[model samples]
Target: MSDAQTQKVLDHIDADFDNSLQRLFALLRIKSISADPAFAGDCKAAADHLAGDIASLGFDARVRPTAGHPAVVAKSNGKGNGGGARPHVLFYGHYDVQPVDPLNLWHRPPFEPVVTDHADGRKIIVARGAEDDKGQLMTFIEACRAWKSATGSLPLDITFLIEGEEEVGSKNFAPFLAANKDELKADYALVCDTGMWDPNTPAITTSLRGLVYDEVRIKAARRDLHSGLFGGAARNPIRVLTYILGGLFDENGHITIPGFYDGVKDLPPDILAQWKKLNLTPETFLKPVGLSIPAGEKGRLLIEQVSSRPTCSINGIVGGYTGEGSKTVIPAEASAKISFRLVEGQDPAKIRKAFRDYVTARIPGDCKVEFGDHSMAPAIALPWDMKALSAAKKALTEEWGREAVLFGSGGSIPVVADFKKTLGLESLLVGFGLDDDNIHSPNEKYDLKSFHKGIRSWARILAELAALPR
Candidate 1:
């Protein structure tokens, strides 16, 4: 774990990354799309390949079956210099890639991997799962390989619990963890699905917003009506739905839901000052999206607008209408898909109820309302006082040659909360995904630099974690 020993491993990483890229290419070519049943065998192949690759580094590795695809688990003792003491780290990543749709957008077959230059002159490796997972997961494994090759053994207790079903919402991962709680238990979990703040700025994701996805349908007049016959007498459910959704946010762009802010607290002054130093503003955040407004709670910073405040959004809506030009028809029903980004301590069930109640209260007599469930998960804000995080921050800073910035991302992993609840483990998210990775999109790519540096970064992290005074 000393600098001299760490240097030898790092040098090995720099020398061996070409081989790492080849390994990752092999993985990326596997077509492990877990959401579709047609790719089941491919998912199993990816799992087995990863398990076998991991076994080559001397861990006890296996590809175990779940109700879904399968999960790869590998374990090694974290005995520093044979001291028999250190933190046991459980690393999590997904081996499956998102389904590649709109295939026409890709320059090559989505499963055919190649390193090509981006339009901007940067070298990027293209494939379906390059950045989403295969690349990200292999960074960690390659780091371990370097450590094993250079130092003869790993520096700390480590286990890899990579699964094939993350693209499908980890439907079977929780049950798998619950079933094998004892074997998978570890001191901390390391997740590589998030990203850096920017290419040069290292980031540690501190908070992830929760989600409540709901669909509401309103029935009126029981059947489609002719506008000429029922124009003024009957209420148009589409109009009513618009008013209801439009009212969720008001003049200053705050959610009008009662008690929405009940659990929200302002950031501390020191943190606010730090955020100010980062210079994250509406212009920088919005310009890329073709917007320039702080469309959330008034007086709060743009960072808070995204990371802290609860938000309401209508994802989609539909009602009866003509397919072509003019069919003046009144719809029997109108429906909209609504989702809320929840903050820490906001109960998903309570928010879901409050939303339904708001709709019910606003509905007129003789109108029937029904709801459909999409998904729900509460926000997660990891504890900062842990020694592992402290060491990790320092090590990442050393690797990037700059201070690592802790951030509050506006998305949720869902499985992080599940890991904590089911295995009593805390997770540290460190990743190399950038805003332009085009994850879950056609022509997805992972920067060659991200892949190379990501492996070296994990090398530094592993050595630094081994040095922690446990």
Candidate 2:
């Protein structure tokens, strides 16, 4: 594939973009909310619609049943050049979307897809799943359509594994992958479920923080006691719980757990320097959230603290009770939900154990501490020198005329780990979403330019991947 051919495909994308938007509209109109059982048929409809649409592009596509919702698997018929093996990629996205609650907050009907002007004068496609997996995934599908339409076949072999349950934690998709591992084999996987750094800047997510969620309950007295009666003699569980949690961090803002940083490592000097150039400051990143302090590991850059470093947070705590005025009673038990954002080299199970141990060690002789596990997933860090990552970065730079930022995201996408674990494939994460796209919220939208250029970016990426050495 030559540069001329790539340009021809990009040209085809520009000419057919309106039809592309219409196709995305068709998808956005479906109310495929996976979290609700009432929308199960809609999820099936979404899977069937995508499979049939993708199959028209010379791919063997089908809607296969999973434990919950169905998943669409599409394989391109294109063989490598001269009938040799070509670089194969498994493209992953989700067709299911978050449920639209608080319907009155929406300016328009949630499923009635429409192009509207944003307050900033940007043209946006407004609907559920707009910047989410639906609009984002269509960029690649349309890119493939352009390639087949312009060049008679794709530049490489491609397989699409679009699922309908990502919004609901993808509990069954991992088993589905394990069950169909052979058919999903690929050199690597391509995921378009992340966001760019800003509207103008493209990004390739290089790492994702893992998660460990736990709940701890502290019980002192067998029953609630009058504050006057137990003020001096009784052990208050709320006070004990807060004190234990408060000590989890030290004066330097580092986690105080004995082995919390055991396996944690620092970012390479070169990457740290690159992050410095990004200039993620409190004014820009934190001010909007009514915060101005870099609260984690004080010496690290704001970007590093949020994206690359590990941290803990107490999500919720409940203990005493108060009515309209006040209740003069000490609660019998106090419980709190705590979560840790873990980095690479940090095991989720180890972190969970350390946290629980730390809390249990501080309990008084008469008090009891019980723990409950919620969820755990390990961090994912892609090899910095991966050829596919390099190829995709170069292609994105060419498409956007800006160097794509390779940054770690503070959030976790559990399926990325599953891809590596079940299918033995590293993932290349690229996406066209922006921070203010309002994804999973009322009036969710995707910028028209993101939808348009995202197609061009994927087109270039496909060409770049095909040209990589076998």
User: Considering every candidate listed, which one attains the maximal TM-score?
Assistant: 2
Worst 10 residues of 2 by lDDT: 77-86
Q: Root-mean-square deviation of each candidate, in angstroms?
A: 2.3, 1.8
Output the lDDT of residue 204, model 2. 98
**What lDDT score is found at residue 306 in candidate 2?**
92
TM-score per candidate, in order? 0.96, 0.98
**Segments of candidate 2 deviating more than 4 angstroms:** 78-84
Residue-pair clashes per candidate: 2, 0
Report how far residue 362 has shifted in candidate 1, in Å: 1.3
What is model 1's C-alpha RMSD?
2.3
The number of residue pairs in model 2 that clash at the backbone is 0
